[model samples]
Target: MSESEQLMVVDEAGQPLYTATRQDVHTQGLWHETFHCFVIDSIKQQVVLQQRADQKKDFPGMLDITAAGHLLAGESVADGVRELEEEIGLVKSFEELHGLGVYQEELRLPGFIDRERIHLFLTDSAKPLTGYSLQTTEVRRLLAFSFAEFARLAEEETTVLTTVEGETIQRNQFVPHPTDYWKTVYAGIKAYCER
Candidate 1:
């Protein structure tokens, strides 16, 4: 799908502003939940990371919080578990994932306000990515980097780092979360791994 095409929005803004899903836009807002994962390999002290697909409409090709995706309108947080399995082929149960917490953020554009609450999780899976499906539509590449490297890269605003892909990070400069969220998560994970 082209990046400009919204899943649930009207092309021509009219009175009362109806959603593309044929619902009252004002009465019904798009509710979203994304799974933000920081797959860790406690044994190796590494974290699994993906370079988002450049074609992605939002945050294209940025170094991001491991595997993440929005929960479809009808999907539940439990379904997010399936997404992790499908996107990265990790055979894990919900109990295996540690609930890091929820992150709510507002991404406002001229006429678009995407207010989202993401369900964050963490897991330890040091397995290699050789047999993993790339899900080209959403993911461009996968590489495991040390948690310290992630902390370093995210500590500084908009920096380039090498992936296990060896691509020299051709696209998407990763920036720190303005609220120090990433750093905090990193510290927590580091401590857990240390234990």
Candidate 2:
């Protein structure tokens, strides 16, 4: 859908308020729902990360969650699983995912006001990097990082020398999600992996 045509159900303090186009939502800093999924390889203790396509308007060429997108207006939260298939070609049903709970994140960047109620999910997979067929317009590449290192990375603002795909990743290269969001995600992933 085109930016102006893509509609989202905006909210106020997590309560649904009204519908707005994607452009309007961001431009106005309206609260909207988004889906985030973290693909983990339990056996290898690695977490999958996607490099955002440079053409992206926000945080282009940065590391981010495995797959994510805004929830369309009238779309059920469970329907968010489509993001997995759309971004990385990794298909799975909603039932197969482990819920990490919803999180609230906000950031004001220049003219963009981002206030989001995010539905986070986690799934452990043994799939290799080459197994993913990335949507080049949304994601540039996919790589796996040590799960332990990722957890540490989320805990603080320091950059760690983590090599993936023969390239080193620094904290500056990641989307600057709030510390609380990272903490919640880390806790959820830890609990899920331990289970």
Candidate 3:
């Protein structure tokens, strides 16, 4: 229940249920949907990461995918292409996106158990980062990090991820995560980059 985000209903088997407030099914630990887009380098060795805006409901400004947003109610996963543009000002089409498989995971934090079905995609944009208009409320800053550096942060627990506006968030120990599902997304992207 982020005011900017939409809520949806789903079946017991995880199909679309209906749209509801975050307070409704959220208490029951059901899953939701999101769209993730990672902007990588030409060689695909680096990823453009965004710090979440300080105003977000979760994680806020911690290191996250290149660009991500909730899939609004009644929206298609394909619509995420537009979200990437609207949120980050990167106008592109599906061809630029290398659709990774949809991923599902559970998140535990601050008295909330968030289950999410994430639609992931990857693309390399040589576009200048400066030319983009940022959705300041959703992203505060952008940084490009090397895969090696990201690995070191996660492995060594050295990198302290904060929202683009500089709000820190404590993470779960059992998952060994840096920021939410970063480790999972990074592992997948790193594997993709290596090959």
Best model number under TM-score: 2
- Model 1, position 54, has a per-residue lDDT of 89
Error at 28, model 2, angstroms: 1.1
lDDT of 3: 0.67
Error of 1 at 77 (Å): 1.8
Ranking by TM-score: 2, 3, 1
Model 2 alpha-carbon miss at residue 38, Å: 0.5
**Which residue pairs of candidate 1 clash?**
none
lDDT (Cα, tens digit) per residue for candidate 2, span 1-195? 357755565665567777888889888888899999999888888889899999998999998999999888888889999999999999999999999888988899998998888999998789999998899999999878776677766567567648445577778888989767777878888898787
List runs of model 3 lying over 4 Å from the truth.
1-6, 11-14, 153-184, 190-195
Give residue 121's lDDT in candidate 1 (0 to 100): 84
Candidate that beats the other on lDDT, 1 or 3, i.e. the better one: 3
Which residue window of length 10 is worst by lDDT in model 2? 157-166
Arrange candidates by lDDT, descending. 2, 3, 1
Candidate 3, residue 121: lDDT? 86
TM-score of each: 0.72, 0.94, 0.76
Residue 15 lDDT in candidate 2 = 71
Quote the lDDT for 15 in model 1. Answer: 16
TM-score of 2: 0.94
Give lDDT per model, in order: 0.62, 0.85, 0.67
- Structural RMSD, model 1: 6.5
